[model samples]
Target: MSTPDQPAAFKPPANDPWKGFRGVCSGTLILESIVVFLAIPAIAKLGEGVGAGAVVYLVVLGVVMILACGVQSRPWAMGLNLGLQVALIAGWFVHPAVGAMGLLFAAVWVYMLYLRKDIQARIERGLLPGQRD
Candidate 1:
């Protein structure tokens, strides 16, 4: 306990939950961005006027999420995703079939967010690699 010139003892983590969840969420965002981007042209051709705007917005938002949060404390990412979900579901009232597919995407996004929240909490509590922000 007396350590004027000595450093404290180092203790490694029992496990790193943050890294695993980070990988999953980051990968999911990348994949979802790709899918949405690719589908944009087709959707536009199908006469969905908002397709381009939606694709651009999603791609930009996903990149920003990765940069700002990197799947760690990704509050922006999760919130934006949930917002999209609500939008998609509301869209169902206008176009049932199309919105149904959107709902599936929304469901997947929500699941990913659910999986990442635990990691975010850990990070916030100073249980992960970095210090609290």
Candidate 2:
């Protein structure tokens, strides 16, 4: 519907940006937080010296994720999210298993971001359902 200079008659998402990406990431974070909460006791048993700190860290991370998801329109939110995912990898200090899980989620984050890009490109090309090519 559009060339290089203008919008098509089939206008697309104009008001919200990155909505799909934000939603996916936010949902993932919610589940991650739940996992962290459930794993607290196990982590506490494994990292005797760092258990309390780990608990606090996990709680704070969840809070930050909530805030980031709430304000995903801000560019910094995604950066903060990625930064936290990297930080989660540091859970290896507490337990190798948790660290391994963190790495898995980190990969998920990466895949989702790439998926988002592909989705956006499809929308732009009118390749999505209900879109005109």
Indicate which candidate wins on lDDT.
Answer: 2
lDDT of 1 by residue, 1-133 (tens): 4287974344344666656665766666566556545544545566544454566654564465445345445646567656655654554543354366567878787677676776666555556654322
lDDT of each: 0.57, 0.73
Displacement of residue 90 (Cα, Å) in model 1 is 6.8
> Model 1 misses residue 74 by how many Å?
4.6
RMSD to the hidden true structure, all candidates: 7.9, 3.9
The lowest-lDDT stretch of 10 consecutive residues in candidate 2 is 8-17
Model 1 alpha-carbon drift over 4 Å, by segment:
1-13, 47-71, 74-77, 84-101, 113-133
Clashes in model 1: which pairs?
none
